[model samples]
Target: MNRSVYLASTLLICGATFAQAAPITAISELSMSHSFIINGGSEPAGIEIDTEPNSLTQSADATSQVDRPGFTPTDTSDVQVGNSFSDPPTPFEAQRTNSQTNLGNGDVATASYDVSILVENDPDIGNAEEDPIRRAVERSGIAAVSNAADPINAEAASSFTNTRDYRFTNTTDDAISFNIVGQFEAEMRAEHNGPEGFARTSGSFEMLFETGPGVDITYFPVAPYLITVDEDDPGASVAEMFFADDGAIAGVTFSGGASAIADGTQVEASLTAQTRYVFSITLEGGASMLLETAFTQVNAVQVAVPTATPVPLPASLPLLLAGLGGVAVLRRRRG
Candidate 1:
């Protein structure tokens, strides 16, 4: 059987005095993605069955390359092109995982996943000392909750990507099943009364699967909802909206503001049923919060199944049904 993939999210609410905002230098923008594929060929004429599943696997990998622009002799901020420069490249990085499984019986499945958070900060926010983006970058820990110095700047971003592939052989003597899984999640938390906390995410996935030969496969229902909120709850919150790709996939949209008296606000996002989580939690005197989390998991298997045979019904069964019908007919006639 093919397991159905789902997208969902949850919120873990915490309370604390809003803390002060941290100095942030994290990248003002980011982009990330994931993908995979599988193909199957004809089955050989053999009198044997296989029981093992082979795989092409990829796990938590954060490999990336950095490229900073080169300066010309006259283009240098200081003197000559070779002059030492004090500026760094814009912060844009990505990570991903991909995997594939092959059943000896001519069946295959492939999956891919990736997620990232990007923050754009203003150099004018207060230089490196007061700029929220730069200070956040200084820490290698959880990302800092800070926005671009202004809306005109690059808006902070969260990215997610996923792809899947599956194929099965053409042998009637074999039965196989495959399930592709993809997931992602991210969150931001702030102590109430002081500092500010924020979080947001955006992602999408594509998957494919197939059963071998004349084998049969069934897929479960897709996930139904992502975030369930009462827009009327009104405390210190924003707008929560949704978009769907028919019945196969869905997306979430959020917006809100924070203030002193209001403790905090959270945004939980779910990409798949099982989403890996990346979060940044902080406490401030005036705390405001935002969060998102998600994950996904599944397995594909190929195995022979016994066909069901019909047994002849007892001769008395038909007579018994007819007798009951006769009694009901007689009652109606009396009426």
Candidate 2:
């Protein structure tokens, strides 16, 4: 019999014999590593998966190229650039054990696995640090003040660029082996530069999979951008939001007046902004079978800070200011 046919027949017989079988306690661990660069920065990333309670852990470390050029190894807070710049990669590890009881069958089976993922930034590892333009750009009073108020300056901004890496592994004791894996990878670049604005760019890639030796498959989700809304206000203008997968505007819109979201608009809304909304997506036949389940909803909102007035300074503010300034200078030098 063909391998596929044989495997199918074996599974059918196993299913019948073990229809009501209970699974014995088993332990499993999973780890993954993935690496990718953003703009011009290197970052290390990884994820861990556990089976007992079924949970996943993911993390990333990133540093920008702009900050490295002037960075020194002795500078604990600074990241070095050029050939000397390197991001310390992080590893993810997980462990789990479970005992499953079959509702109707008497068959007993046990299966376990370990998976890992790692991501890293390479390619633009070393480069010179110079302003993009030969001359300094002009700034208005508002722009100057905004730049000064920025917690992360141009030098500190680069540190945000991060590289990613991922890896996964599985181990099983049962005669029948089964595993599920999926990934959605996309590279995005900011077309505009501002603290709060819309940026746009485009790229292409493919999603491939292998169930086992010789069992491989590939498919495109077509319109990759499945959902789009004001990251700040999902209820904002539907016209401002676009669903790439369908390229249909009717797929996403809100009754609110936030109709025209510019390319770089920042979304900030609270649950109290408005009632929650829901959107659903259905994939094509084959795609749907490959990726079961479709409908998902965007419900509720989270607001971190409340709107309030600034407190006024008292008459003795000058003395307090002088003392604070002295303390700040001392901390900086020591820091």
Candidate 3:
């Protein structure tokens, strides 16, 4: 599983770093890409979902993007895709409610969501068509969103909504709490890129989350479970936590740059931009619901250092630029 591979590699790398450097105990892969069951009650009233970033903003070069998860509750015993509620369950990132669509047909059984912003003009232009995530999904014969839409106007959202069973989405900025039957272990993470380009670290560079300009990342008073720096896949099954000593999380952060080189051209030519950052989780607690502002950016791209000639940026240049500032992998696990 990619989840296990992600945690295992993080453990091996960060463990060594922390051991050698004052026992920092900080892991490089602070990103997340898994979901937990919301089985909290005989029936859950609703799940409180928030995709807003809870990390701090330390510098201008950093960026952290949030990927939303789909809500999936069975209308029947069989766990078939048709039985699930939300459209395209994996990689969900919108904020709609049961009115959109849902499962079980109960008063609040279904829900739906639509993208608010697909692309940006101020910083990254014509990014939708070049979306790496979307491209990856398309390769699997499924459809998912990158951010906004075609002819993407400055700040307009999409018009379509995903309605399905156990409704949930990759929505941002707001927590939509609809009547639900299960208690979800909802966790937020700096979403990552896969093997496609510079890797998942592109979106996670902004992982150093902060609730306020100078405030620390802490747990919400009413959180159901203790928020800690832990692994997912093998984590849920393993006895001990994957990353740290199962340290409780106060906040999340990142520190990265070209170890060999920083120039965009050099990184691509050498294929070294993939491994460019290290993520760490701060040990703090006693809070929940975090917020911050972020700019829409792409990951570090695989620049083909021109052997003899310089050329214009491709239509995919926007996506390419987005890839410029992310994870140091293999050394290579982004969120």
TM-score of 2: 0.19
lDDT of 3 by residue, 1-335 (tens): 23323432443343333332221111111122211112221112232223333322222121121222231332211111111122332232232221111122110111111122221111121123221111111000000111111111011011121111111232333332321111111111111111121211112221223232222222222222333332232111101111211133322222221111112221111111111112221212222333221222212212121234434333233222223222211122223
Winning candidate number (TM-score): 1
lDDT, candidates in the order shown: 0.20, 0.20, 0.20
lDDT of 2 by residue, 1-335 (tens): 12213322332354445434321111011111112122223121211211112112222121211111222221112222322133533222221211122223321121111222232333243222111101011100000001111112221111011111112222222122122222222111111122322211111111111122322222232233332233244222221122212322111111111111122223221110111112222222122111111111111111111124423223222112122222222222211
TM-score of each: 0.25, 0.19, 0.21
> Candidate 3 regions off by >4 Å?
1-90, 93-250, 255-289, 292-335
Please give the lDDT score at residue 113 for candidate 3.
19
Measured on C-alpha atoms, candidate 3 has an lDDT of 0.20
Tens digit of per-residue lDDT, candidate 1, span 1-335: 00111100000000011212321111111122221111111222321222112321212221111111221111101111111122542332232222121112111111112222222343332222111121111101011112111111111122232111112233333433332222222121111111122222222222222222243323332444343322232122222222222222222211111111111233222122212211111222222211111211111111111124423223222112122222222222211
Where's the lowest-lDDT run of ten residues in candidate 2? 136-145
The predictions' CA RMSDs to the true structure, in order, are 28.5, 27.3, 21.3
Mind sharing the TM-score for model 1?
Answer: 0.25
